[model samples]
Target: MTGPAQNALYAALFGDPQTEALFSAQAELAAMARVEAALAVAQSQLGVIPADAGPAIAAACTALPIDPQDLTQATAQNGVPVPGLIAAIRDRMGRTPHAAHLHWGATSQDIMDSALALRIGPILALWEGRLHAILTRLAGLAADHADLPMAARTYGQAATPTGFGAVVAGWGWPLLDQVQAMPALRDRVLRVSLSGAAGTLSAMGPQGPAVRQAMARALDLGDPERSWHSDRSGPGHLADWIAGLAAALGKLAEDLLLMTQSGIGTVVIAGGGASSTMPQKRNPVGPSAMVALARHAMGLAATFRAAGLHRQQRDGAAWFTEWLTLPPLCIAGGALLRTADDVLERLTPDAGAMARDLQIGQGTIHAEALTFALTEHTALDRATAAARVADLCAQALREGRDLTELARGAWPGPDWPALIRARSLGQAPQEARAFDRAVRAASGGLDQGGS
Candidate 1:
């Protein structure tokens, strides 16, 4: 799973290597050990476990001198790794009373859950940085292309004129919202889990709440008011948020695929895929990877919903199912975010091709503009005037004369220059700049300040 040829995804295109390593077997074990150490210290502070035992146990977890192969074998036998991990740490400590106090009050779920939260906090921060980069790049694109005209389409046919910057803003806002939401999402999802045996921390006595709170402080995680042994809301929301983000990126990828097509060519991507046999084909490879990853996330979101159906307090079946679902979701999300940022950096909109697309309708593209201009002289309302001008433009296309020529013949007062030039960019430039301002606000104006 680590190498390119073996797993391909974690090493190749679909997973970020840094984030991938964060969820690796060694990382997971180490994190679990950290959680165990924190629990020991927290128990010692509350007088639930001996003070001398806490230092030795914490040191063992910190050093992680236990062998990986032994832990793996024990995990297979015990159905979870913490029992084996604890045995190894205790054996390494080598004393009856000192080793006896190791992991006195915590359960396997507590270690695993808290360890996952520890890993996730860092992962979410990684995404926040990546998302900030995206917002910065997108804002620049919006501002630079605020006036760049492109033919707008409805139902895959030319509808009117619009600026590409405005379209980019639509993409920017969803990502902005996601970025804005990260802090709260992390707070909610990265809570420390310290419930023992069952939902209640019965083994830790009445100081259970304080010990849990102390552990939360030790790990820099949110201290839940109650143990979330059965409550899957936090993890579910994180998955949903990531899935929504991937879905938004998928929308962008869909447009990128369409705009980069052979005939359309409204977009130019720097690094595209090559066809094996067809030397002329340069495929939209990045967006294609994005589409595949997004689809994977969307599909996993459904499985997560089913996985969250915990059968009462602590369904080992349901919890194990999450083990199968969430890590891949994280991998896909991390990879997609990176790919999207790269795609944005490498993408170039073909201003010339966009202008040419406007001409494909052969002046019929300006019918809406013409129709509005005709409203001044004629007694016709907008709909009637639009239909009247549309007819002339359609007939002109068939007869090979210009729309302006036909419009002047029929309506007499239409302003040819103003009407034919792309119109109704109404508020588009302002909207683009507004998105830039929002980015500045999020970054505390540092990203584009004094520029």
Candidate 2:
């Protein structure tokens, strides 16, 4: 029978050739090959093997095609490193002296950890690009809609008037913070772990340091002070970063879902999904999917964190758990990024609806500002002016007249209307645009492929 179907995310990550290229299984395999070559060279240089064999072993490794099935079977039997790989290389050399130096002075963890670093390098690059694209789209939206006022809700109740740009800025600020934090995360994820068995390069002696430096350079990973066979810092830090990103995406998705509600109608989605059963339904499918994927990614990160509590010197449970957890986290992150981009792209702002909603609570949003304006001209105190404005607002709502007209009739001050309007919004749009410009400049001109 066919095995249970792989997760749809797996199909996205590993089945689709274009997106699958981001993960680069070949790059991971090549990293392992380089580690093996580095180990042989280090061994030869340290007098553990004949110096003449180093170049030949490196050449043989470069020429060999690794059998993936053999590697899988070996991983199932032992924890890692199919003995078949070394055996296959030895057979190719046919009792030659260079064949004897295949994987000298290194253990399986060296290859596996370097492979993880190689995998993370490409993934982080993709993340930085995707996140910048999404943030730029958000910034553009905020700039375009900066002055369009809408009702702000807290605890599901209408509170005050706020611009759509303010809402977008709320999401943008956190995203900017997350983007700033990514470089450190990238460094942590791209660290090379090349210490031989038992967290020491005892097998390669004095040449170990040089070999590790060379391997890191070849693989484009950072060199660590020592091997972290059981330290578990890299994966744990990666999990934390992934979780934080997912949380931010989830917040944005939640806001989109709320803003698209039928009652709100401040924003409309283009090309939303329609129900197969009900032709009248236009569903917010993209935002819904983002919320689901964010939840999944956060849960996977929790699993990774739990796996970090494994016992010393490589716990099989923790290591194997990652085989199931890490890939899904990567896929979910990719999906979230793609969905955020699409959602921001297709969102249509309803300036008319926002204006209508600002007028919904019977001019309550203008109450305090009107009160302060009235306080300056009248004999009344602040509280009395507030009460008088509240009474006038209630009377205007019942009598079906404009609150501003009523205020003008009741107030004798010549500047009352202008003062109230001026305080309605004070420099909010300018501040948002400044913040957006800073984010764009910091993100290197909104280009996805920039540094």
Candidate 3:
């Protein structure tokens, strides 16, 4: 095979085909070819190179028939792919004058960086749509389960009761943050790089800025005004987005893993992993993969962070580190979001299971609500706690009795039933509705030709 299967058995579980293509050698070569063509055109328009050579240069950039094996061998010597690619284009151009202008006044970094911007533009856009869809799905779930009462756990123990919709909202809100943050991040990272040799654009003269602007316009990328030869902060923003996304999805994965535990059984997912030996096992296959990908991405993102420390005007170490790290990150980002979306689509909440879990603590989960009721009736001295209500709640839990019954015995007039009722998801239902409303507004904005 020319490359790894984009969606082989293992890959399909944690890879995105569209994004995988974006980082392919063919895609990289094609992007660089387009940048070279556009560079020739821009230079031609400025009366720099022969205008007649522009079309020929563009024609030579056509992909296919060019072997990646050849480029790989050439790259070993040249330290970059453009020199090999330019040589191939020139050879394909058949000793014509147009071949002379194939990469006029441009360095390998210029071609590669500009091509990366050209490629990343669409990649960012794809993620935007994906994130928006995930958010929309989460918002719908939140609205549908606004009153779903589930035991909210803290430090791995049931602390209180909360709406499952609120839990879904917790998974979603960070993604909305990412969705809301994408435009700015795109502007930061998808910038055209046209500073030749050492970022001075000394070869292009006074027209360098104009050519950069023209190329940015042609490639549909942002122009960074100054050249970013060693300034990788642009791509760093992309790393932040990728890492932030993984962390958010990791949270979702954690919750799903916990909720689908054999004992909890609160989350019901389709296509769970089956055991080879143990027929009783229905493993959470998708959540496990997504969580693994997220953790892997977190480590890779740290590489990008460490990559920020470049040496001098250019550091081969950092640049090469990015080459090693960034592409996988983009791929993982696509995969995580796609898997999370699928996980949500097939996910169902076992309401009965959640209610049953609330009983496991034998009414100790209602201690907070009981405390509030107690506080409502009378004020307590700062040190009045230890032996009084604590013993009652502990006794209730140990004896498999209801704390509400004990509280009712004590207060006599406090509406004890209301305190333990599922209806007391204080402000959770309203927050769920608010998220639903926000999603609707964003959708409407989209329909009305806004972001």
Candidate 4:
């Protein structure tokens, strides 16, 4: 309850249940046990332990009834849960001949890190599912509103006209890149760690590398070939990926936050939060939470990266820092993705309000279109045409008239509506549909390790 992610009051708002469960103490213990079992079997297969010991150790690891609560005091004393875990497993084996072979030549870091890698496989799988759902929803949004015109803003002011589809696509391209990078990321980060003690398997002598490879194959993980005891790059890469995903989702949330403002209500979010004091308030709760979670991820990512500064062969301080930072960082990322998917599911674009805002500044949004038409169809140069349009825009604002009308009065030969339409949403529709196509093509590969 001390952690906001698991706190009863805040869990629904900020926590991701699946992510929490994966990183939970019980889950960690199970993963560690799995690692131990794999290590035992691998050692036995490589002749480092007795042939009969492997199955016995594996069975014990699977069937041992070691509660996580029983390991807390030991974990606090030993700086890791593996010692207590192995002890509990050995005790459960009860002086059996194979009990001595359990966790042989393996350090606590080996079990712990390998267990984390095991858990990461399912976590990545979860992310793949979420990404597929999110991209599908976003593609639908883009296709549905491919030509729906809206005022595009820059620097907190309306700049020009754009389609809502393009705006949605902007939020999707980064995520698509993330999806594409999943395979490489998994290869880089989801590797087995089997460095014994000071990263050299001295106890197992020459068969150590073989044992490590066997364990990696048994656990369906990548083998780094060298010990990563002092190399924290794997975890660092994961933190970076999580932060990047959060930032991408945050960008969408920030745009939605602006679009849903009181007077500039271009996007309507259904099921907005009700303000207790205000009778007419529909606060953007999901976007707000996404933004907050994204910012939290940013800070946690920095700390996580710093934890990569491990000293020499092993640094308990840096390792402990990672334990403190990674779980919450991962949870925040999951919540952000979950919230973004939910928000996109309920989002509705207000065409009427968008139209109102498009013409809010006396049709000045079309000034760029007017300037381009003046240059293309007329004799004026680019600078001259731009200046002339600027004058017309000022006149339109001063006289409270439409810039289009004034521009047409000055230059009548060009087809105004056709010209404006051609220039306003130049590549927005195409861009949106391109994203839709990309997502569709990648859909089949998303679950298969991003191909």
Candidate 5:
């Protein structure tokens, strides 16, 4: 019911404690202070500010010399928290000669955006770690179940027989792509923003480019080489990537939901939610949460992309829209990944249940395999074989008998049981092992070390 990761009621369900702290108000204040300190140092080194002022500001920032509560009212009046933060830093260094050089020529957007990059550095690392963990688990699952036969469903109906490993591979392939894209995303999105008042370093004069590059070095971020005050592509790209990751997790959740349905219990998730009145209920709570979180991230991502319409040099309305949406979108993505890792760790496939569902419609699941066998092993043409197979499938359904049993009466040439077993899992095992191989190649090994 509540918004924001700090919501006491839904924090655990929809927010990741670690990532939430990274986006908290106090953390934001500290990050902005770090940006200010780094900017002062960079400008001082470039002879744009007093050298003593740089060291003094750095010391004040290291001390984090301000109360976050004091900025609430000031931020309401100033429209951005950077001004309040700067004023607080000045107050903390009263009577100090170097305090005058605290902010130097940098603008509010520079500090805030650079601070966001600072916090995002560690957040990206955390997300990559979680992503690698999930991939490792999925690779194991695929390898183990590569030969385990199960019915593959399409449009809510059994379409063909596939190994459970192939099903697992389907869930992990997109994740593999996400992990691979992390390096580029980090490089492009995590950069310094050092534009002056109007996308030009007019205040810093001729030394602006050097100052920005020095600040980038001081803060361990990439130099954008130009102002991004009016260009929201970095944030837009970040939102798109987060939404994509959420969608991947959502697909996995949806599949788990169907697999755990009552009549088709192919997967059993541990620690499912219990019904208040129903005694024998084990609800798929984790998967359900992931699905909901994915939807939330998707909606926020659309809004964030729309907010990229930065008008002229700057647009307060569009900027404020990002402030409203980006934090929750990031939180939702983190929570989805956390939930997926937990769900995968606790998941157990029910081979018996899968086998039972494979024959749900009187062995009609083998219709494709039967048709293929007739053409390949006998003199029957493709059309004749298909029609004959369809006819036998109808007879088996009408009489409530196995299709293979009826096929024996129709075609006695091919070894029916062997043919069914051979064709039931066409390339499914290969597909699963191929995924495992890819994970191993990408990760160096399956030891869950790094991405």
Candidate 6:
């Protein structure tokens, strides 16, 4: 029997190429290269090695080619890349004792951490692009449907009337806020880890600081004041950020799922599934996928958070869990963004149904505003006007008359006609427009950054 087909991600991360080339996998490899070079350079500068050897070490480290399969096999046996990588470099450099300076003051965690930062740089770029596309699509949908009226649901029951734009805006604003915070969050994830052996660079003497600074410059990462060998705050914070993004998408997906329900029939989309069993059913594919993707994201995010609870020095179990968690989280987020873009792009507004549902509550949806308007022309207080409107609604329900006619006869208010006519909407359009502008502006900035 054949084994399962290899996934692209697995091949990229574990393949035999000198470079992984894929964003996440390459990050780990790049970090390793940078740390190795920096350690050699630091040793030469501090007079621990021949000055001429520094340039040779840097050149060899960058250009050296090793069998990826060999590294993989070594990792499987020893659970780390340093052992195999060291052997490969020694082989390339021959039997010269100078090769000993290749990894002079560094440890396994240093290279691994650097690799993680390299991976984050590219992953963040991908995430930013997905976010911009999703936000831009949502803005367009909101703008096009700004004045389109729809039922406002509270607790799964129709409570009032609102515009479709407002509903979309509610989802867009919070997501935009998250986009604005991404750069800082990325910085937190890009910090460099350079402490050797234990939490201190004691093996490198006083030159550790200069070497660390040079390493940070070479890799475009920040240097923490000291080693964070056991502190998992950076990884934990990143996990939380990802989880928050998933939650936002999940909320949007939940709304689309409900709005597209057959019973509600408030929202319509093109190219949804046609049931195989029943030839007549048009399934809401976009919303359904959105819901599924969001759920998957939530589960992976939970795993990422759980992986942060490792005890000091580094728990292999918890650290290894990240290998399982981060990739799925990234993939799920990408899928959700893609699905949301498709869903919003093809969404069709049902103006007639929205108008009809507004009257389902016996015009109670418009009653609150009408009551406030009536108080201006009559001696009755705000509460009295509200009571009068309630009475008219009850009578209309019993007598089968329009609320507008009942209000005119029973309340004798001058503004009753205009107030009743304006009841089918609220602040939804204005909110949608404002949200659209914000989303476009944010997306513009992200696009400028090539996200």
TM-score, per-candidate, Cα-based: 0.94, 0.87, 0.95, 0.97, 0.97, 0.86
**Each candidate's root-mean-square deviation in Å?**
2.7, 3.5, 2.1, 1.4, 1.7, 4.5
* Per-residue lDDT over 244-338 for candidate 1, one digit per residue giving the tens place of the 0 to 100 score: 89988988898899999999999899978899999999999889989988999889877887888887778888888888788888888988899
lDDT of each: 0.83, 0.75, 0.83, 0.90, 0.89, 0.73
Clashes found in each candidate (C-alpha, N, C closer than 3 A): 0, 0, 0, 0, 0, 4
Leading candidate by TM-score: 4
Better of 1 and 6 by lDDT: 1
Query: Candidate 4, overall lDDT?
Result: 0.90
Candidate 4 clash total? 0
Q: Model 4 clash pairs?
A: none
For model 5, residues 330-379, the per-residue Cα lDDT tens digits are 88989999999999999989999989989898888888988888888899
The candidate that wins on lDDT is 4
Residue 177 error for model 1, in Å?
Answer: 0.4
Tens-place lDDT per residue, model 6, 294-324, is: 7776787788888878787777788778766
Residue 164 in model 4: lDDT: 96
Model 1 TM-score is 0.94
Worst 10 residues of 1 by lDDT: 1-10
* Residue-level lDDT tens digits of model 4 in 1-451: 2488899999999999998899988888899999999999988888999998998999988956777889989999999988899889988889787888888998999999989998988888888789889999999899889999999988988899999999999999999989888888999889999989899999999999999999999999999999999899998989999999988999999999999999999999999999989989999999999999999999999999999989999999999999999899989989888888899899999999999999998999988887888888999999999999999989999999988888779988777768888889989999899989989989967555564
**Which residue ranges in model 6 land beyond 4 Å of their true spot?**
1-27, 42-49, 63-68, 387-402, 412-417, 421-424, 447-451
Error of 2 at 238 (Å): 1.8
Better of 5 and 6 by TM-score: 5
Ranking by lDDT: 4, 5, 1, 3, 2, 6
